[model samples]
Target: MHMMLMADEKRLCKRFFHFRIAACARAHLLRRSVCAGFLTFLIAAVFCLSLFSAAPVKADDKVLRVLAWPGYADADVVNHFEARYKARVEVTLVDSDEALWAQMHAKGTPPFDVLAANTAEIQRYTEANLLAPLDLARLPNTRKQLPRFQALASIGGLTSGGKAYAIPFTYSSMGLIYDRKQVAVAPRTMRELWNPRYRGKVLDFNSAQHNFSFTALALGYPHPFQLDPTEMRTIAHKLVDLRRNLLTYYTLPEEATAFFIQHKVALMFGNYGTQQVELLRRAGADVGYVIPDEGALAWLDCWSMTRAAADPPLALAWINYMLEPDVSALLTQRQGLANTLTAPVESSDSARIVWIGPVENIQRREDLWARIVSGDRSERF
Candidate 1:
C-alpha cells in the first residue's frame, strides 16, 4: 500500500511540473526571469508536498498561546520555546493590568491558553471562573522554585479549595531610581521623591493604585492596601505633596526612559523597578536603583492556564519549560527582573516587599488621585 501511494504521488508531481512548465512558456507577456522563477517554485512545492504526504499532522500541533507583559515573552524567548517543543507559540504583550483584563474577558471565554498576571489580577480571573485548576503534578519545575513559593496554598490568591491555580514566575519591587550624575549618592528611601530640593525635577508613575499605596507607605500607614478614612485623607495630602514636587507622571517604561534623559530627571518612582533601570542604562544614562528603607511595593507575576485552553497538558509543559534554569535566567539577562527559580543576592529574604492586594477602594483612590494631580489643596481633602 505504501509503495502504491508513493508511486501515485510521484506520477502526480510529474504531471503538475510538466503543466507548470508549459504554462510558463505560454506566458509571453511576462518577464522570462519571473516566469522561470514561478515555474521553479511550483515544481519545488509539488516535490515537497509529495515527500511529506505520508506524515500525519496533529490537530493542535502543540500551539501554545501566551499572554504576558512586555519582555516576558520576547521574540528570542518564544523562539527558544518553539524550537524545543517543535510547537507554534503566539505571544501577546499587554502594557497595563486593565488591558490584560480586557483582552482576557473580551469574549465569554479567554482566548489565551496561558497568561502571566499578578496575584490581584489572578483573583479577578478566578472569581470570574476564567482560570483553570492547575495540575501541579504535571509541573514538577514548581518544586525547583524558591522555598517561599513552594507553599502555593498559603499564598493569598494562588490556591483555592485545595486546587492550585497559578505558579510563581518573576517578581520585582517598585524601587526608587536616581541619576547618579545628578544625585551623588543612592536615595535610601522612597521619601526622597518628596524632597523639596528635587522639586520640579522628579517624575512619578501615572497610576492611582501605585500612587496611593506608595504614598500610604511613605506616610507610615500600617496597612497600605486597606487604609482607613483618616489614613486615606493623610495619604491624599501626601500625594498632593508628591504632585507639587514633580516634573510629570509617566505610564510606560519606554516613555519614562526617554523623559528621564531629555528632562535630566533627578528622581523617579521606579514603578517597573529594575526593568526601567535596564532601559535607562541601555539609553546611556548613569542611574542607581534603591529599595527604600521604608520598604517598596512589589508584584509577583505568575503563570496560569485559562479555562478556555484547548490542550491542558501542552500548557503545563510550557509552564514547566519556563521554570527551567536557562529560561528563568533570561528573565534577568534580558529584562532585569528576579525570577522565582532561585534567590538572587540583591533581593534579600529579609527585604520588605508589601505584596499588592485588592485596595480598600480603588475607585475612591483614583478619584482622589485625579483631584490631587489637578492641584487640589491639602485642605480640600
Candidate 2:
C-alpha cells in the first residue's frame, strides 16, 4: 500500500510540471504577438508624421510688382529688397520709352505698382492720370538728395496741378562719343554729326523726339521741345541731311558699341551718355565723351507710383528704398548712371544740361521720323 501511494504522488508531480510548461508557452506566444502589433503601430505613426512634414507650406502673400529698366532692378538688388520687406518682387524690364509706355497702358489699371520713367514720361503719365501724387512725408530719404532734386518744382514734369507725382532717381546727358584714334579733338557741337568729312562714319540714335530736339538745339532754337510747324519742317530737312552722313542708326548702347568696334565708327551721338562711355571703355574702345557747347539733352529718370497701386504704403516703401545711399550708389557703380543722392564726376559745372519736357506734337514727330527712316527725300519735309 505504501509503494502504490508513492507512485501516485510522482504521477501527480509530472502532470503539474506539464501544465506549467504549457502555460509558459502560451504566455511567450502572447508576448510575441503583442510586440509585432506594437511594431506595426510605431511604423505607421512614423510614416504619418513624415507625410505631415513633407507637406508644402503656403507662400508669402505680400508681392510687389515692379516695372523698371535693365539695371534699375537687378537680381541682387531685387533680392535684397525682398528680404528686407519680407515680400516677393516681380520685376519687368523695359528697354525703351515706347516699350515702357506700352507696358503701362497695356492693362486698364497699369499692372505695376511703381515704375521708373524720365521726367517727360512722368508728365505724360500725369496728363493721362496714370500716376498717383507722391506723399513727401512717406519718403524721408528725399532729405538726403542734392539740392537740385529737392527743388521738385524746378524740375519739369514732376509736379502737376500743385501735386508732386514723381521723385528723381537718376539722370544722364545725351552727348557725343568720339574715337580717340580717329578724331584728334573732341567735337564741340552737335553740328559735328553732319560734318561732310565724317560721312558714313557717324552713328545716331534712332528716335524721333530726341533727333528733333537735338537738331533744334543745333539750329539755335530757343526751345527745342516747343518747335513750330516751320521749325519742324526745317529740322526734318536737317535730319534728312544727317541721314546721308549715317552708317546706321542704333537703338541700344550695346548695339552702338558693337558697331563702333566692328565698323570702325569715328563719331556717334552718345544717347546713353556716360553709361555708353562705361560700356565702350569696358569693351576696350578708346572713346571720348563730351557734352556739346550748345547744351546736351538730359533725361532725369524718376520713380512714380501708379494710380492703381494695390498697396500704397508698399509702393512708397520701394521708392524710399531706392533713395537710400547704398541703393543709389549701386546704381552709379553698376549702371554708370548718376543718382540724385550724389553729384556725378563725369559732368562739368559749365556743361549745360537741358532737361527734356513735353514735346509739341508726338504723333507728328513720329510720323515724320518714320518717313525719314524709310529714306524720305528732304523735299518731303
Best model number under lDDT:
2
lDDT of 1 by residue, 29-96 (tens): 24545857888999999979986984565785878789999888778778888888888888888877
Structural similarity to truth (TM-score) of each candidate: 0.78, 0.82
Cand. 2 TM to true fold: 0.82
State each candidate's clash count: 0, 0
Q: Write the per-residue lDDT of candidate 2 for residues 1-381, one digit (tens) a residue.
A: 999999889756644543454354346446757978989899999988987986443464677889988788888888898889877788998767877888987866438999999999999999999999999999999999999899999988999889899999998989889999999998899999999888678888888889999999989999999999999999999988886567777777876787788778899988888888889899999999888889989998999999988889999999999999999998889878899999888665444889888899988998999988776667767
Q: Which stretches of candidate 1 lie over 4 Å from their true place?
A: 1-62, 107-110, 370-381
| Residue 368 C-alpha lDDT in model 1 | 88
Q: What lDDT is reached at residue 178 by model 1?
A: 95
The 10-residue segment with the lowest total lDDT in model 2: 17-26
The window of 10 residues in a row where model 1 has the poorest summed lDDT is: 21-30
Cα lDDT of model 2 overall? Answer: 0.86
